[model samples]
Target: MRILLVGDEASLPAELSDYIGDLGEEWQVQTVPDGNAAISAVATSSIDAVIVAPVLPDLTAATLLGQMRTLRPETIRIALIDANASHRPPSARIIGMAHRFLPLPLAPEVLLEALTSLEELRELLDSPRLRSSIGRIEKLPSPPHLYLSLMHALEEDDDSSTEDIAKLVAADPAIAAKVLQLSNSAFFNNGRAISDLRGAVTRLGLATLRDLVLASEVFSAQSLSTTERNALQARALTASRLAAKMLPESSAQLGATAALLADIGLLLPGVRNEHDPAEEGDDRPGHAEAGAYLLGLWGLPMPIIEAVAFHLQPQRSNIRSFWVTGAVHVATALASGLPVDEQYLARVGVAAKLDGWRNSANDLITLPADA
Candidate 1:
């Protein structure tokens, strides 16, 4: 892997250099003093990733990262900012530019882990043709207008009420149905059904509701036949519920949301039926990578992004424990009538729990369509 470090040797701490050097001959590390040199190197070299310091001689870290984003969209971008600087709110521009943020004075082990994870993710999404195809897409789905409005009201002003967001969600039947369905799932429902959208919103809270709406909007934007759309939604809903049930309480919400959006890449322009002759082989980009790429661009949480990217092949991830990716993988496999990978389940120490999860998924599938 080729990494570009944008900062002067004096400013770029020695610990970082020593850590990178420890990776041995397999990794090529280069350091440049300022943004101009960094940009020039990016234009001339086949850089795989970039790490930029908060302060540079000529340009700010945000400016350099933003330009690098346009210049090398495939390259991984990491921002090294002071830990104390996190007290101030980050600008939207910076958030959109850097794929990952590492507070400086970072431990050498943490930096190494981050780079290792990035390399694994790159391998999971390894397809130049698919990257080119996604880049040329002119009409990728946008977040629902209601979602946007709700986010605006919540972020820009404090006057937005739960009732107001609930009403906005109710205005769209598709989004409303999804919210109610998730609210009544085994994870949220406590015996009684949530008959109203307002009650559903209250149960789910604003943050979780927003993610569901975004996922629903992407589903709605796809040009799918009713049967295809319904089948996909059913599988997604089942997978999401199973994932929530299997995860720990703290990460259950994120796991469910990731599973729900796991299949979104199937809706991308060039993607078609898995059995279609043109896409019958592994040469084409699968739904997992495409969905992850789009969501990454939309600035979704990194865990959710990683889950969507690696759900199809969770073993590709560097983390050894059961995380959002593992939950989604197991849930998706069960929902699609495929046997869970016993080795993976054993590796994660969740093999014995598969039977119970399968039962939960079966019950979810048997629920009333409008339930």
Candidate 2:
């Protein structure tokens, strides 16, 4: 695995470098003391993952992630918080670029686990099933210009004025309309009404607005049977709501966007029948590969694209990626009415693995829509 560690502190960088070196000869780790150097490294090389610190001399991790949006465009970006940072992982911060949040006083074991798990996931993804699924899948939809523009704007420094953001939102009527609809969706549950695009943007904020815009952008690109489409939508809404709850303070908008797009591979264009008895156990293909391929094409952040691409293979994914993938796994399973009892969940990893997910299983299972 190739990793880029960006921070100003000499000690933190040294600590991280030592831990990564323990992973051995195959691991290639690079350290950039500041965001500019990090951005330059990303622009010049291929990096699998990036670990960024929030407070750095030259720039904050947030600033680096924004620049990275334009630089690598596809790398998974994670925030490394000082175990002691005063502010929590604010929702807006997570929305912008953070895929994973690691508190400082870092443990070598946990760090190694994230790296090892990442490698294993990459290997698992190279399987025959994924290859076959990718071959069978159709095209993926691109985010509309409005959606892309907002993402780019959000990645900007404060110099990116609000008027610029408002203009971007105002340009696409269809995207704007969907943004308003989603803003008013039960997810937001605004007691008061949101009447227009500007109102939606105001009520939702740029972070939330950006997320919904991307969601609507991808929703327009899929083709699915009514039943399958409805199921996908239900799972997405349920996942989005759960994501809001689980990651109550984290951004990962792309993660939420992945939640909406995760099951789309199940909507493969040429598959005539999903329930045909003969098709069962055929194992000719699966959803992960198709979804991953589609997301990769859409320029989604890698963690989200990978999670959507590999949610089913729990044992194959690394711990950090597992957090997101596991959440999606349980959310989708609950939304689909799969059993979430201890025994069933044990077989599923999530039922036994994630405390938050385990505790919420019954409530999630019994939700009016999912039930």
lDDT of each: 0.75, 0.59
Most TM-score-accurate candidate: 1
Question: Which whole-number lDDT from 0 to 100 does residue 184 have in model 2?
Answer: 73
Candidate 2: regions farther than 4 A off: 1-124, 127-139, 143-145, 158-162, 184-193, 225-231, 247-254, 271-283, 320-322, 340-371
Write one digit per residue (lDDT tens) for candidate 1, span 254-342. 89888888888888877643423453355656667788876665545678878988786788766699989999989988888876677
In model 2, how large is the Cα lDDT of residue 45?
91
Lowest lDDT block of 10, candidate 1: 272-281
Give per-residue CA lDDT, model 2, range 303-329, as digits (tens): 676667655554444544335665565
Per-prediction CA RMSD (Å): 7.8, 11.7
Off by over 4 Å in 1: 1-126, 144-161, 167-200, 203-212, 272-282, 365-371
Instruction: Give the lDDT of residue 75 in candidate 1.
Output: 72
